[model samples]
Target: MSYAANFERMGRGFDLAHAIAEADRCLLCHDAPCSKGCPAETDPGAFIRKLRFKNITGAIRTIKTNNILGGACGVLCPTPRLCEKECSARFQSLARPQGADRPIQIGKIQRFLIEHSWEQGSEVFDKPEPRPAKIAVVGSGPAGLSCAAELARDGYQVTVFEARPEPGGVLRYGVVSYRFDLQFLRREMEDIQALGVNFQCNSAIQGKESAERLLKNGYGAVFLAPGLWAAATLKPTPEDIEGLFSSVVYLAALRDGRLAEMARRIQGRTVAVIGGGSVAMDCIESAVKLGARDVYLIYRRSYRQMPAEPDERIEAQEAGVHFLLLNQPVDYVTTDHNRLQGVKLVRTRLGEPDDSGRRRPEPIAGSTWVLEADVVIEAIGNRAPEESPEWYPHVKVNGQKLIQADPASGKTSAAGIFAGGDIVRGPALVVQAVQDGKVAARAIKAYLDQ
Candidate 1:
């Protein structure tokens, strides 16, 4: 079975009439709490108002002014937890009938308007002139792209270096294509390119010396937004087994068409995914789509405490993925030939709050069990690449290896150097990284002006 053939988008966008209706539903609150809730500070009120008035180009400009990747983010960002959650209409609806208690569909409307513009072949935003100052951006993920777009708009000669062959880091290589279309991502990159942002793919900037070399070569500033690509440690890593895989590696393979090429290798096999985050949800769903006979999602925490978005879990469940919540993998059960067999698991109970402010999972004694697994995928989390600090020695890193940058500015300890995205904040929302890039662009401009 072709895994790519089975992919489907999670959210259905609004039609033109429905989009207009949704745009009209926005009270266009003066304060615009919805825009404030957005990390990228997208002016939903402005865009929706423009859409309401049938100014399609104006609406697109209003969005791309703040978020260059507005189209992709319209599908990727969890609007209910962010912008829609803060929508005034939500509170206004609470006073109405029960069934009518719904906020304006900000994400869908944005998706419709932006997509409509692209279909029309209309310019999303005006191009900016190139300035004398040259700046280098490491990574082509949301943060790097956002920063590059914003800086290029300011007339800086910006060049983005991507380690992979493709421009989008996680958005292109890690996220499932169904979640965010690769073509849309490339189009957005093209938009940034239109603004004079040059992208150099397969160019890995090694260490601090390499970055220093860029500075020596006369690049005014450097922004590090290379995201977390290293798979996080799974205690008693099942790597010794032949059928085990890391979630990051698995997704990358799937995104790059490698997994589909080898689809026969995993066809009809029982697959178990370990973790509670959105990545795990993607893994299980991918497994099912890849023709896994049985797909199991094993989570150490309860469903309520799962780090994944609520809708993501629902989508996975609807895709025929079985959930084994409150179960933690202890070890692997393999055959004498070193082939994969099963996973040894133990029951877990929620305890007091942990560092993440969620209830910690504690193992229950004497509750060991085994679950059959032809293949096991660990989707727990990702670690920052170790090459980070070594590449920019002047920057400080916390215990987790995340770069120490100002939350508001994305500035590092070293002048003319900044960092953001997963490298600074660990794995976070793409919108948040976009906001970081916007902030970093302003900071870099300020430094250059000084």
Candidate 2:
């Protein structure tokens, strides 16, 4: 089935009347905990109040003031766990001696207002007097885009560089289309671009040469926001099998309209995805959407311990994907010279908590079993590329990977060089990346003034 068909089956978009009604349900609490809970500090209660008052433009303005990527976040942020989770209404309900009502559907209402404003061609930026400095943002993902937009609004000349032919980075390539449509992302990018932020597509900052070139090209400050691009290694020989793939590669293909190629290779077959993160859930859902008859998500931990967002896991389950919890793939079972027939997996049990405070998976002896499948997709995690530190050794970094920057300012060790997003925090939520970019933009502005 086509992507549109899948969305139709999944109920694409939200109901406008329902959203407005939900917005009216907000208690509009004082010092709203929802806003405080947001890493980006998006004032959910205030925006919802604006929506309730029919001040759509004001709501959009409030959101864009703090988060340029608010359009995307309105649709993609895990509000159930962040904003809505901390809603005072839920607390009030609990205190009522009986269940009163669910928390205000803040996320859906925010998405409705933002999407409606964009559809109505409402202006996204407030006019500002021109400033002196110019800043260059590498990677046009949430971080780069947010930085560029904020800097542009602050009257600074901002230019964004994206190695990929298109902007939006992982939002376009890594995120599943079912959850976030490309058209919405493109609209948001266009809105930011209209604010005088220039974007140079298919431009890569590979090494020191590129970084130096950007600096010499009249850019006052350079912000490196290149996200994690290297997928973590999977042990054993299964990764070398013809049908085995990484979630990054798999999702990129789907995003780039190469799903037909993937479909032809694994259509009408059973597929196995190893990992418990959101990426793994995306892989499983994508496989099913691409015509995999039986898709299994095998993870080494229990459902509670799975790194994936609970809603994502539930969505995957609703999409007919199977979960093999507490199981780790040991090796691939090969039948022919080039085809992967299945995976040899061992059941696992939770052991002592690891450094991250999550119980580690330990292999259960003699619990090995073979799960038949034609394709295997690994979705463990990803790391930042090595070229970043090599190009700018002065840039602070926690390890060879992970750009190290001030939590408040997003400033690196090098003067006039800032970093954020996945490059700094490793893989993280889109909203957090937006927060990083906004923080970096403010810091860049302050530094340039000096």
Candidate 3:
């Protein structure tokens, strides 16, 4: 059986009738809280209102005006945490004992309009004539792509330099295919391309000299969005042993079609994945699809505190993946051949709130234990690349090692250079990165106009 065939999209988009019904559910509040909750500030209320009135083209244009990657945002964004969570109907339903009112399916409706326009061969966005000033965008993730699109629309010549063979960055490589199809991403990229933004694939900008060369070559500005490329390790055992792998590397390999070689080596073996975020869930699902006999999702936090969406966790559970909560891996129990064995873990408990507002997990002193594991995948987190400071000597960074820039403008320490997305804010949602790119584009445009 083809593993790709078995993996399905997370949700089917809404049809026209259902999309209008969901749009009608919106109260059309004067000050839409759902729009406020949206990081990309797509103005969900206005679009839904237009959609309700059967103005499909206008609704899509409104959405694209704020979020260049509106289609991908519809599928990838955590709606429950953002727009839906702040819906007035959701609050109203909560206030009333039996109100039965729910937040409008804003994401589904947006997806419907965007996908519908694409299917009908209608215009989804308006383009402007090219200007004289040129802008160079490094990276092809949401941030780089969004920034490039915005700049291109303003008539500024925009060229996105991507390190990978293909663009889309995380949308193509980091995310699991089941969450969103490659065709969906391809369509979104085509929209950006249609806006006159040029994509230079297989072009990696390594250091300050690379950026300086762009400036020397008449590019007025540069936006660095090289995302968090370094994966957090399980100290002292981060090496690529016969069975050890980082979730980031593993997922990228799976996306690049290279995981099959490694997957076949561990067929029917038990796999233990460590983390509590959506990426961990992806790892679990991918391992299952790769024919792993048993998959265990180990997290140091409780279920309620998991960073992943509840629906995602539910899907994993339904797929027969085991959830091992409140467990922290301390050591790798390797075989004498140093090939593969298991992992040693310690029980943990939630403590006082940490800087992130969630309760910190404390490892119990005597709660160490070993679990069976043919392979161990660490999905803890990712870090900024170590060569960043050296790569951009002029830019400043915070103690956390993230780029230091104004949140409002995405302005960096150096003049004519801006930064955003994972490189600046650390690993975050795609919508947030899209907003960063939009903000940075405006700032760059303002600087150029001055």
Q: Give candidate 2's whole-model lDDT.
A: 0.83
Candidate 2's C-alpha runs over 4 A off are: 1-4, 7-11, 95-100, 236-240
Tens digits of per-residue lDDT for model 2 on 405-432?
A: 9989998888788888998988799999
lDDT string, candidate 1, 261-294, tens digits: 5366577999999999989988888788778899
lDDT for 425 in candidate 3 is 86
Report the number of backbone clashes for model 1.
2
Q: Candidate 1 vs candidate 3: which has greater TM-score? A: 1
Which residue pairs clash within candidate 1?
A: 207-391, 208-391
TM-score for every candidate vs. truth? 0.95, 0.94, 0.94
Give me the candidate number with maximum TM-score: 1
lDDT, model 3: 0.87
Q: Which sections of candidate 3 miss by over 4 Å?
A: 8-11, 94-99
- Separately for all candidates shown, the number of backbone clashes (residues 3 or more apart, or on different chains) is 2, 0, 1
lDDT of each: 0.86, 0.83, 0.87
Stretches > 4 Å off in candidate 1: 1-3, 8-12, 235-240
TM-score of 2: 0.94
lDDT of candidate 3 over 152-184, digit per residue (tens): 988899999998999998898898877777888
